[model samples]
Target chain A: MRENLLDVENLTIKYKVKNGNLFFNRYREFKAIDQVSFNIGPSETLGLVGESGCGKSSLARAIVKLVGLDSGKVTWLGKDWTSSHASTDRKFRENLQLVFQDPLASLNPRMTVSEIISEPLENYRKDLSVLEKIELVKKSMETVGLSTSMINRYPHEFSGGQCQRIGIARAIILKPKLIICDEPVSALDVSIQAQVINLLKDLQKRFSIALLFISHDLSVVKHISDRVMVLYLGRIMEIANVNDLFSNPSHPYSQALLSAIPIPDPIREKERKRDNLVGDAPSPIFPPSGCVFRTRCKKSTNICSIKEPREKIVKLGHRVACHHVSDEESK
Target chain B: MNRLLEIKDLSVVFDTPDGSVKAVNNISLDVDRGECLAIVGESGSGKSQTFLTAMGLLADNGRSAGIINLNGSDLLNMQRNDLNKLRGNRIAMIFQDPMTALTPHMKVGEQIREVLDHHQGLGKKAACEIIREMFNKVNIPEPDRRMEMYPHELSGGLRQRVMIAMALICKPDVIIADEPTTALDVTVQAQIMDLLNEIKTEIGAAIILITHDLGVVAGIADRVAVMYAGSIVESGEVFDIFYNTKHPYTLGLLNCSLSLEKKIDFLEAIDGHPPNPNNLPNGCPFNPRCKNVRDICREEKPEIKIKKQNHSSACHFELGVK
Candidate 1:
């Protein structure tokens, strides 16, 4: 079996929000991410799929230490790094990188492409000379399909796809073992998205880098992920291999989400058996007791509201969290 | 042809400091009553600008020249007062972001009532009754309670429903929904699309859907117009666009999209980025990225030629998605 590059256990995150009524000094805790646990192996991709405001971003941030973790244990290469500080955990910081959702906003407009790409080098590669840094930047730009001569140009001069290439270049310049691509290609066109996704796959093959690809799109996630995790209201609904998850989704939420995706073929779209969620997700602040998705589940029962269901193995490796899900769900 | 809305040779050019950028080139299409025609393209493809110009909404520096004949009336050359009288009555627009389109300070019911008030001159009680009925028709639960709430108090899905209710309040002959579901989640997008399809059948009004997603087009649109660099590269029935796509750009688009219905190890991506509008290539705007581009493609542009009974393409070579 491949070695685990990263492991997370019982990760829980909460934010403090003031009650709307000002008559009393009272604050409530909003659980952004509940006790979630998952792992990624070397050179493997763990796809995180969820709707907006579902705590996918929060969990990613917590892993890289961008946000403060309320309680959790994140182990990096068999070492605990969750409570570690930035100055002391330089190796961990250098090894994990982030590619943001908005290409234009994530990149600095005033900074040149070379400078934006080389910033990580400056932070982590003080040992390399100016010539070595320039050589490395040129090679990295070429790896992402950008011309070496365009390094001196600014971000505003490039298109959305080119800007995202710059972002990927910056993330990979350090040769980080793990790259957290948060909706990396969602901002680009379909053709451009294909280009970027292919680039990421090629780079991963060359560098053997594990990817934490987060996106709301089921189709894009299924394209590049080794395993997929479904999140709802700060909790995991299901986690399975990409093929198993897409073909035989066990959780009711997963079934509904997969069905809601608009297939490209007209005949397939018309003939597909669609399972739509009844309504929008309830507020994260007041998430329902027991199962977070019980309010929207089609097979919801009295037991769903009274008791929280733990993760159960539905297949050889697939696990799902739902009271209504049975072994028959995998069939 | 019994077309409700017909646009001929529609072009939009923005006078910029650098140069005049052609946002929408000489493009033409039509919509019939009780049918949905979707214009699908990338961000800079000018699909939205084509319909925006029809609604008499263009930036100060932009100029448009086209024959937008709606029910035999030239909407492009119509006087401002006359067009204003028809707008929100015979033709309405739904923007991408419902929050910005809706007034935050006003109640949802009053905002919808204003449409009926201005167009039909209905009394307050009469307007409220019709507005509440519209809310119910759009599947908004607790119509009375929702009518009193502000835009922020409602969810993203609900707010879009209110916008649709307002747009259909006057029962326009044509409704231009520009990327209406782009901002919503997938589940919510399905809900909104289902609601829209239901309403279209009930009202028998033509729908012009502008979006960048081909998946959405496959689900709801009867006909598809694939736009590239401000011009329509392909126009055909939805079946033709999905199953028998002809244009190189359309083929590239169909090949690149990831599918949940099937698994693909790799994607056949188009090589280069879309050309800049101000400095587009001389021949085919997509020649820079087309794999089968020839020397002649660099010298001259091709016009939209008929491919089938109801299908047309604007490509020099015979390109098809395999």
Candidate 2:
């Protein structure tokens, strides 16, 4: 079996939300990520998908140590790096990187392309000379398909697609083993989105980097991911191989999400029957009892609301967390 | 042909400090009653500007030429007062972000009431009745309670529903929805698209959907127009544009976009970025990135030509031919 690059175990993240006026304020814990567990094998792409408020971003931020974890463990290559102090380790920081959603906003407006790309090197590679750093930055830019000549220009000078390339250049400058991308291409146009997706795929193949890709667009996730995880209201509804999840989704939430994606073919789009889920996702602050997706699930029953279903093996590499699905599996 | 809205040789230019920017090059298209025409393009392709010009909502630095004929009336040359009377009454527009488009301070019901009061001269009680009915039609839960709540109180999906309700309250002949589902989630987007489709058939109002998402276009659009560098590169029936594509730019767009229908090893991204409007290429705007470009494409600009019945493309060489 392939070695696991990153292993997340029963992770839970919560935010303290203050309610009422300053005089009578009460802090309530809002669970953003609840008891989620997964493992990413070396060079594997795992797509994390859910609607907004489903904790996809929170999970990403927690993994990168941007947010404090309420409970659980994050193991990086057999080393425990869950604490905030462990994230400060230079080796761990260099081996793990993150690409943000908004390309322009994530980049520093005042910094030039070369400066932005070389900042990570300055943080990690203290032994490298200035000339070597410059060469590395140029190489990274070339790898992401940005022109090396435009290194002196500011982020504002570049287009959206070019700015995104600069972001990728900065992320890959350290040659991280894993890159957690949070809605990376949601802000870009369709055509530009394709370009960035291709670049990521190319870089993954060249460097053998594992990716924890988080996105609301199912079509994109399906294109780049090897394994797919479905989340709803901060809870894992299903985890399966990409082919299994797409071809035979057992969880109700996954089925709804897969069916909701609009196909590009006009003839197929018209004829295909859509199983649209009714009502918006309930707020994460007060998620439903037992199964978080039970409120919106069409096949939900009394057992789903009364008891939280444990993860059950549906097949060799497929697991689902739903009372209804578990019952069917047993039968 | 029962054309409800017709735009003829329309062009929009902006006088920027650096130079003149040709935002919307001379282009013409029309929408018949009950038909949905989708304009697909990247950010600066000028899809939004074309309809904004038709709505008489251009920026101060922007100047528009040519005629926007809506039901035999030239909207481009109309007076400000006359245009205001026609806007939101005969023509309605739904924006991408409902939060910004809606009034934050006013009650949601009062906002819809204002549209009715201004256009139909309905009193407060009559407008409230109509507003509540519109709410029910758009599938908003608890229409009575929702009308009194502020825009912030509602969810993103509900706020979008309110926007749709306000746009439909006017019962206009044409509705120009600009990236309406861009701000929504996939599930909510599906809901909104279904609602829009149902409303289209129910009211028979022509819709002009301006978006970059080809998936959304394929679901609802009767005709598809692909724009590149402010000009339409291809326009045809939805099936023709998706299957029998002619323009290289359109073909690039389709090939590049990832679909849920199937998976491919690698996407064929169009090389190079879209050309800047102020400094477009001398010949074909897409020649620099086009795979089928030839020496002639670098010398002379290709004019829009008919490729098949009810289909047209602007390219030096037809695609799929050696």
For candidate 2 chain B, the 10 contiguous residues with the lowest summed lDDT are B254-263
Q: lDDT by residue for model 1 over B1-322, one digit each (tens)? A: 6699999999999999998999999999999999999999999899888988898988899999989999989999999999999899999999899999999999999898888888999999999889888888988989999999999999999999999999999999999999999989999999998888887798899999998888888888999999999999999999998888789888889889888866777789999888889899999889899988889889889899998999999988787332
TM-score of chain B of each: 0.98, 0.99
Model 2 spans > 4 angstroms off: A21-23, A84-88
Q: Each candidate's fnat, in order?
A: 0.76, 0.76
DockQ values for all predictions? 0.82, 0.83
How many steric overlaps does candidate 1 have? Answer: 0
**For residues A153-175, what per-residue lDDT tens digits would candidate 2 score against the true structure?**
99999988899999999999999
lDDT of 2 by residue, B129-184 (tens): 98889999999999999999999989999999999999999899999999999999
The weakest ten consecutive residues by lDDT in model 1 chain A span: A322-331
Tell me how large the interface RMSD of candidate 1 is: 0.9
Poorest lDDT segment (10 consecutive residues) of candidate 1 chain B:
B313-322
